[model samples]
Target: MYQYDAYDQQLVDERVAQFRDQTRRFLAGELPEDEFRALRLRNGLYVQRFAPMLRVAIPYGLIAAKQMRMLAHIARRYDKGYGHFTTRQNIQYNWPKLEEVPDILADLASVQMHAIQTSGNCIRNVTSDHLAGVARDELLDPRPYCELTRQWSTFHPEFNWLPRKFKIAFSASQSDRAAVRVHDIGVQIVRNETGELGYRIYVGGGLGRMPMIGPLIKPFLPELDLLSYLEAVLRVYNRLGRRDNIHRARIKILVKDIKPEKFAELVEAEWAQLREGELKLRHADIEAMRQRFDQFTYDPAAAQDRSYAKHLEQDSAFASFAKRNVLAHRVDGYAVLFVSLKSPSGVPGDISAEQMEVVADLAERYSFGEVRATHDQNLVLADVQHKDLYTVWKTLREHELATPNIGLLTDMICCPGLDFCSLANASSISVAQDINDRFDALDHLHDIGELKLKMSGCMNGCGHHTVGHIGILGVDKHGEEWYQVTLGGSAGNDASLGDRTGPSFSRADIAEAVERIIDVYLEARDSEEESFLACYRRIGMAPFKARLYAEEAVEAA
Candidate 1:
């Protein structure tokens, strides 16, 4: 919801102009395809297996209704009338022509959006909790910090051409909905005992060749010193992180080799030196940065002790929606509504142009004309009313947005594997559909309770399969589609990467394997309240492995 300042406006404007020139040269054959690929990728353009794909950053997954309208316009004017929301809280257009990208960037600039840092080896988009401003449990709204980092990292001279792409995420709330743990840098926003806002900084966490959880580089860094502390961490990483081998280039490899304690010591020494430098952000600047999140105007009339529960008591569909989709907002009257884009028999995060317009209209009409995209590949209305819950549900249902499957098995986070991605060996959308179709029984999924089934076609972990309660990764084995599974992974405060569960399954064997794993969970669980992750953790991998590998389970026992 942050509006772009003049400097922000000027920066994106200049970049867009520069990219236009680059694009013109590439089209004119002055630049070769390989040369253009690197240039364009740094600007968030990719040449997929078919056409070139352009990824547009939705910073921290926040979008205004006006921005949504802009996206719809982009879909209508440039793309194939739809946009695929990515797992990184970004949006991608798979069919973007190489020549049209600069024009697309121009349109995005008008809306205060861009693709900068959405790709490249430099610091990528700084993701945070999508429900930042609205989440009641948050220590502070994280967008200001994320925006600050965005400014500092964008075209940073030193780290601009790092060994590999670095991702950073901030989580301000009790829940780590942003999957901060799996990022290159994960900042857990916290308030000290003195009630001063600060960060618990984690460093060198990533997935790819080496999936390691970040270690706490700073247990508590004052909010004012966040930028300086971050600079220290990155400085250490840039100086020592490997460059000779692409596989060992990430900060994770450095963190692992240097040991977390030594890494922390180095960061501390660097911070001791530079903490007083020009980058030390002042309280006034923080407040100025904070003002942009003030776009939403609350309605006191829509406050609590309302009769909306009575309507839910009357209508079952509304009841289901109200129960599953709504979340607590910091404001008394406002509520956060998770509009499920992961509807039955649909793409996980693909919202059509009409759907986009409808949500945009709803946000403007009911909420505060503000929308958010979750890292979980869902849409959010950050300030819905308790009183207007049924009306919102009705509108969403009419637009086919009301799926009542938030946090359920069907609320899957998936990548556009094989369908759009050139690196993938198998189709993930079909795998997601198989699971959705099998558990189409909503009651059964609800009974299983809060199951996060994340899928990815490859080990890049875009879909965050490493952290899913039910993680499924697709691998190619001897030119055949094969699926690998992992369990007990979580991305919250107690974050840990899922361990691989051995032996890949055929495409035909995937659903059955999932069922077998679930069956083991059901049998081993202490109660229905115990989730798949909880059960798996409590009873180790032995039970689940037995069930998953059993001949009877493979043939449907």
Candidate 2:
């Protein structure tokens, strides 16, 4: 994790003081609502349906154990007893009072965290692979670059108010776990034939009313030119992107209207001027940033524990947890353990204050005092020792954090829908609950295998439904709640948007429709090993659509 220097600390402290005064003025009627709106948004505060929501940035999804404890404290003291972890790897407080937000920001600042640039039409949090430094197939660690980008973009005067919100993600592994293809800018760290590291930059990728997989703009951007190239892309979009219509304001829209080739040409022309400018990364600076991250000390005897093998053989429950929640780490004796927030008892990403504290304790005790928030709304203890698996599993199970449903049907990515978001059309949390009840059987979910079900309350695509194997979008039709389903979408290296399954389903029928879709997949699959996504891709949408609408077709007849 990158520790803040005096300048960073001073900047945040000054911002906190500035926002506190601004907030006081707004309440005192000295600041106009319109003016305050921009100021509050820049600080990551949003007025929701019932209360104010505060989104705190967890840069590149990395948080120290102490920061996690601060988050728990904030949840307990300022907002509701729980907070929601978002798809962007940030945390959201749904019930924070308007007057107390400055206090929250101050509390966050104490831990070197803040809500700056988390919202508004600016470059939001710079995200990366949750498995960044620890993935076996990684070509380079993307966190240093992510941190560099974050430092460069925070409060950049040129991009402070873009046409629309901008997002950037980085991935270094062979597998694109960061979902880089769906970001406004996606940087894939790659090594060329000469073994020199650089980036494969993709531009114009986004999901909303118009979903797109970003096209490759620069197949090989030099290591030193990252910031310069990004500036060029932003400059092009900031100049030509639509300002008249919010719907058409995103860079994706501009890229679409102009064609990707033209967009690339414009970016290239801009880069030709700025490539060797002040934004160019120096080798010394890069090395210094890399050295800031603390390395973990792994136990040499971790892999030699016979008790771990015995526990796996003796306890079926522990074995199942180890099988589902544990992922292979780059280190020989370490594993990445997922703390599932998707327990059937509550909302997908919502974690209670006590639960947060538990995770912090576990992270400190087992994973080198570090925690990672995943884009899929899960917490990861990225460096747990192999020998401590059973103890960690037991502790997590006791706290309802060991769901053993990672990448399963029940382990879904969902947004705070009508329940919290004023822009939502229907209730995402309730829909998720309904689906969880329907597919409560772990054995059944395991049989279905590796399904990514993402649900969004509206077309904002906050839940990333377009990229799920099964995408559910909530819609309002004549004041009634309905859901539109899509199939075969993926956020992987081979990213693609899903195809809609004909008509929308009533709230009552949505879960059943999902069940019917799953039934069709199970019956049609060549073998148990074939995933739902694989089967859907092989047979196409015809079969799933037919199954989903078969009853409606009969009723119509």
Candidate 3:
């Protein structure tokens, strides 16, 4: 985790004080509601259904144990006793009082955290792979680049107000765990044929009402030009992006209308002017940022431990948790442990204050005091010793954080829909709960195998429903909540928007509809080795749709 330098600290402190004054003015009626709304949104405060929601950024999804403790303190003192982790690697406090939000910002600032750039149609949080440096197949750690970009974009004078909210993601892993392909700007760190590092830039990728994968704008851009090239891209978007219509104001829409090739050409022309300018990345700066990430210390002796293998054979429950939650680390003796916030006992991403403290303690004890938040609303203890796996699992189990359902049907990506969001047409939390209860049998979930089920209350796609293997979108039909299902969507390297399965199902039948679709996959799958996405890709959605609509007809008759 990169500790804040003096510059970073000063910026956050100033922003907090500025917002505190703005909040005071608004509360005193010196500022109108409309004027205050924009100011509040710029600071990550939103007026939701019942109360204000505050989104705090976890840059590159990296947080130290101390920062986690601070978040727990904020949740306990300010809002309700919990916070919802989001798909963008941020956390939201849904019930914070409007007047006290400035104090909450102050609390976050003490821990080197802030809400700036987390909201308000500017460059949002810069997310990266949770595993970053620890992943076995990572080409390079993307955190330094992410950090540099975050600093460059924070309150950038030229891009302070873009046409719409923009998102950026970086992924260096062989597997695209960061969902890079679906972001506004997805950068893949790659090596050229000459063995020089560079980036493969994808522009115009986004998922909402109009879902599309960003096309490759630059096949390979030199590493030295990372910042300059990014500036060019933003410059082009800011100049030409639409402001007439809110729905079509995103960079994706601009790219779609003008075509990606033209967009790239415009960016390239802009880069020609700014390539070696002040924003050009320097080697010393890169190295300094990289040095901050080199904190992991592994014990070579743990590599020789045979106890982990023995324990796996001896304990089925522990083995299940290990198989599902434990991930391969680059070091021989180390492991990356994913803590599931999607336990069936609670909402998909809500972590209680107590759980936050427990996670912080576990990270300090077993993972070198570091934790990473995932894009799927999970948490990662990225550096655990292999020999200590059983003990870590036991601790997580006691805290209800070890759910042994990673990549399975029960581990769903959902949004706080109509229950909390004013933009929602239906309730996503209830749908997720129903699906979890219906698939509570661990054996059944394991059999389902690698299903990415996501749901959203409305078309805003906060739940990322467009990218799920079985995407469920809630729609309002004459004041009735009906769920629409999509299949064959994936957020990985082969990112594709899901296709609609059939007509929408009633709220009562949504879970059963999901079960029927799963049953169809089970029957049609070539083998257990075939995942839900793989099988759907092989057979298409016709079989699932036929089965689902057939059930609908039977009920109608």
lDDT by residue for model 3 over 1-49, one digit each (tens)?
7878899899999999999999999989999989988899999998889
TM-score of each: 0.97, 0.99, 0.98
How does candidate 1 fare on TM-score?
0.97
Residue-wise lDDT of candidate 2 within 1-557, one digit each (tens)? 78899999999999999999999999999999999999999999999999999999999999999999999999999987989999999999999999999999999999999999999999999999999899999987899999999999999999998999999999999999999989999999998989888999999999989999999989999999999999999999999999999998999899999999999999999999999889989999899999888876778888776787899999999888888899898888788999999999989999999999999999989998999999999999999888888899999999999999999999999999999999999989999999999999999988998999999999998999999999999999889889999998999998999999878988888888888988999999999999998898899988887777777532210
Where does the lowest 10-residue lDDT sum fall in candidate 1?
548-557
Ranking by TM-score: 2, 3, 1
Which candidate number maximizes lDDT?
2
**Model 1 lDDT per residue over 1-557, tens place:** 78888989999999999999998998899989888777898889987889988999988898888899999998888989889887788988888887889999999999999999788789998889988888888877889999999889998999888888899999888888777777889998898899888888888888765788888877899988988888888898888888899889999998889899998999999999999999999999999888866565577777754678789789987888877899888988677899998988689999888999999999998877888888888899888788877788888998889999999889988999988899887889999999888889878878888888889988777788888888888888778778888898888877888877878788887887887787788778998788888888889999888777767535321
Q: Is candidate 2 or candidate 3 better by lDDT?
A: 2
